[model samples]
Target: MTESLNSALGTISSVVWGPFVLIPLLLGTGLYLTIRLGGLQFRTLGRAMRHAFFDGDEEGNAGDISNYQALTTALAATVGTGNIVGVATAISVGGPGALFWIWVTGLLGMASKYTEAYLGVRYRVVDDKGNQLGGPQIYLKRGIPGGFGAALAFLFALFASIAAFGIGNLTQGNSVAAGMKDTFGVDPWITGVIMFVFTGATLLGGIQAIGKITSAFVPLMIVIYVVGGLVVLFLLADRLPAAIALIFTDAFTGTAAQGGFVGATIMLAVRFGVARGIFSNESGMGSAAIAAAAAKTSHPVRQGLVSMTQTFIDTLIVVSITGLTIVASGVWDQGADTAATMTSAAFTTALPGQWGGTIVSVSLIFFAFSTIIGWAYYGERSLVSLVGQWSSLPYRLLFTVVVFLSAITEIETAWLFSDIANGLMALPNLIGLLIMSGLVARETRAYLKFDPKLKKPKLSVEEFTAAQMPNWK
Candidate 1:
């Protein structure tokens, strides 16, 4: 039965994620949004960064976290093994052209992520307990008509929550533990246990605590990883121009077999690039919107701008670093998993010796650990959205348990399950986004026209329902 189920899922995943579907779905939505929003993501990126860190609207808004913290939390989940492992996997399988596709996805995805965050904040409602609740589900059910929207929203949240456990937690935790064991010779079980304990402790403090931790951890780890890659690239400075040229050249012309490389077609490059790009940044997956909903801001566009930056940092900066390192070191030709370990090997070979391996291993541990923390909150919110606030306790317990279980699982199965759930989670959310895109455009236009320094628009009596407010301050 499990095998049959897996087979069925694999077929569905192929259909859903195929270029015919996913490419148009993702790129089309982003293009539509970019046109509708008048290229707001590009125009406001610097301003968004300013508001995100320095001049944030930290007036104790009724949300679980501040805008910066929320962005960091989402970034924590995003800038994970995907940046390290997923990029290597793409280049290894899809060839250099895959890196180009990843860049394209990130560029367009910035607009998609901005739209998701905008709608997330605009349609957000406060629960009976004054807690804020918003995401694709909220926008779909509330903004759209009839029982169909409600059903789809419910389904999206349910599957997305499950996916949170798979892609968001288990896959990440497993990678971290495995990396630690491979490099440091620590027992996988021991690493898992330690992760479980640390996750439990942080989650106990709730979203605020989660946000604080991610804010510190995400930026620091990204700097460390990027700097490490820069060092590698600098060591092989002469090859830098050649590596860049190869990404575009091999993208079209088939890469001839070199060393252990089996060569690749343009199709393979597109496939692996789009797949790993989605895995890394997750712009349209609707997961980041879960965290975006919690940002403390008066205008949805403010948070949306900040949200867009996550993709920029994830793909444009971090993943690019990984790609350059692998290409420069010529490690992609080595027939290997081309994920975390391969990237680690590139770093090790590029650097002096054990130092490169040590840096990557440590960085992966921190990046993946923070991802687990961030995704735990996403799961918690999704569970709360589905069941109730009371369900959070048992949900956390289950999440912690699964983190341990994931550590010992086969990497192939772990990645497969993560892929399936990620696809499932994306469907409903994308539907919601498509349906409510008009509203997203409307809200974005209004926010852009209205000055951020101005007082917030007064909520109409109809809009002042308890469902429209947030629980936290």
Candidate 2:
């Protein structure tokens, strides 16, 4: 039965993520939105980052966390193994050219991320307990004209919450523990116990605590990892041109067999690049929207602009660093899993021996831990949206247990299942974004036209109503 289930899930994942379905769907939607919103993401990215951090609007906002906190929390979840292991995997399987496609995905995804966060804030609702609830689910049910849309959104949330436990919880734990075991000889059980305690402590404190922790850790981890990657890149300065050339050339004509590389086709490069890019940035996946919903922002567009930065940071900057380093090191052609191990190997090759490995191992541990905390909040929010706040304690408990299990389990199947769930979760979100595209565009236009000195339009109730449609309660 397990085998059959795995096989079924694989088929579903392939079908859902196939180019014919996902490629055009994702890129097409982003293109349409970019035009409709008058390239809001591109024009306002800098403005968005400024508002997210420096705007005093957070002081009087009605949400649970600040825009910066929310962005960091979302970034904590996104800039994880995907930036490292996922990028390596894409380049290993898809060739250097995969990096180009990854760039494309992240660039287009910025617009999609903007749309998700805009609707997340605009359509958010307050539960009976007065706790805020929102995301694509809220908008789909409320924003669309029919009950069917709401149902689809609810289903997306359900699967996404379950997926958080696997992808966000166990898989991360597995990767971290495994890396520690391999690099430091730390016992997996020991690592798992430590992680359980750490996660339990943070998760018990809820979103505010999670946000605080992620906000502190996310920046630290990014700096450490990026610095380490830069050191290696600088060392391989001579190979930089060739590495970049391979990414573009191999993306089209296929990688020729050289060194340990088995060569790769353009299709493989595009496939892996797009897949890993989506996994890394998660622009339309709805998970980031969950975090964005909690941001204290009177203007949805402001938060949306902040949200776009997550993609830029995750895929465009960080993942690109990892990919280029691997290509420059020429380790990707080795028959490796394209994971942290591969990235470590690449770094080791580029740098002075074990120093590279040590940096990657330590960085992965921090990145993975932050991801666990962020995803725990995401899952908790989804559960609260589905089963209410009373179940939050039990949900946290279950989530902790899953995190422990992830440490000891071989997570390939779990990873595959999580991928399917992610794809499934995206479907409803994309539907909602498409249906409400005009509303997002209107919000952008109105916000741009309004003089900041005047009374901000009365949007709270409308936003709440849009979020709490017939599908929610």
Candidate 3:
């Protein structure tokens, strides 16, 4: 039964993430959003960075978490194994040139992420008890019209909930356990039990718990990984230029099999690069929107702009550094099948002794932990959307169990489950983004036109809620 199930999942995954559909859909939607937003991702990058870091919540802000906490929570989910393992996989299968396409994905992904954040916040609602509720579900209902919106919203919630089990819970646990086992020779089951306990303890406290922990953990882990990568880059400074040239040339001309590399066509480079890049940044996935909606901001567009920086930090900065270090160290072809170990080898080679390998292993543990922390919230919110607040406790418990199982189980099947679930989740969410793209453009333009000095909202939260209440037009 297990073998058959794995076979079915593999077939489904290939179909779901096929080069003809999912890739083109992701890339095209991002490009469309970039044009729709008039390239605000590039133009307002400075403002976005300021808002992400320096801006504080409005006095008596009406939300669960501050904007920074929300952004960090979202970042925690995004800046996970995808940065380390996913980058190595992309380069190994697609060659060094895959880095260029991945960069392209990030650049365009900024617009899609921005729009996802914007719509999430714009349609968000605060309960009488002050609980915040929103995401692709709310926006699809508020921004899109009629039955189509309602169905798509529900589909998104369903897929997100399912996807969370694999992408957020099981896959992460497996990665964490694998990293720990590889580094310390510990039993994977022991690591699994520890993660089960830790993640459950954190999940039991709810969104506030997630927000605070991720806020602290996310930045620290990112710094650790980035500083380690930078050390490797500095050590291989002379090889950096050649590594870069190889990436660009391979992107278009194809990479010839050299060393352990099996060669990759240009098509393979674009496919894996775009796929892994999406997995890394999660720009159009709509998961970030769930966090963005919880931010304490008077204007939806503010949080939207602020949240877009996640892609910049996750893909452009963190993932890029990892990719560069792997390339510069000339380790891309080594350990071809074991991408994570391949990445670790690069760092180990560049830094003296076993310190680099240790760092990568430690970083993975933290990254996977934080990703689970963030995804716990997403899963909770998804259940809440489906079955209301009553579902939160049961969902968290179930999520924790899956995390434990994921750690102890073989990870090969976990990868297929995660891919299929992710593709399904992205499908409905991306459709919604494209359908309501006009709203994103209109809302963004209106927000940008507002005077920076006039931060006061014309309508209070209550007034704003009253004005934008859902109506089927």
lDDT of each: 0.80, 0.80, 0.84
- Model 1 lDDT per residue over 1-473, tens place: 66776687667766767778776787777777778778877878877777676774555456878888889999999888888877887787778888998998888888889888877877787765676788886776877789988897888789878988877787787788778987999998998888889988988888888988988778888899989988988887988898999999988875777776788888778767777787889888888888898877766767888889899899999999989888888887885454658888888877886878888888888888888888888777787888888988888888888888777766656666777777777777777777888877775665556554323443521133233334312
- lDDT by residue (1-473, candidate 3, tens digit) is 87998899978876776788788999999999999889888999987897678756554556789999989999999988888888888898899988898999999999999999988887887643467888997788767889999898899899998889887877788888888888899898999999989998999887888888998878988998999899889989999999999999999999998888999898889877887898889889899999998888777777888899999999999999989999988989763567757778889987888898899999988988888878888877876888787788898899989888988876667767877888888888899999989977875675566534324464543344344433311
Model 2 TM-score, 2 decimals: 0.92
- Please give, for residues 148-230, the per-residue lDDT of candidate 2 as tens digits: 87697788779778878766887789888878988899999999999899989888888889889988878989999999999
Q: Candidate 1, overall lDDT?
A: 0.80
Question: Alpha carbon lDDT of residue 300, candidate 1?
Answer: 71
* Model 3 TM-score, 2 decimals: 0.94
TM-score, every prediction: 0.92, 0.92, 0.94
Model 3 has an lDDT value of 0.84
**Candidate 1 to native Cα RMSD, angstroms:** 3.5
| Model 1 spans with C-alpha error above 4 angstroms | 1-10, 336-338, 452-473
Provide the lowest-lDDT 10-residue window in model 3.
464-473
Off by over 4 Å in 3: 1-7, 127-129, 452-473
Measured by TM-score, the strongest candidate is 3
- Per-residue error for 336 in candidate 2, Å, reads 4.0
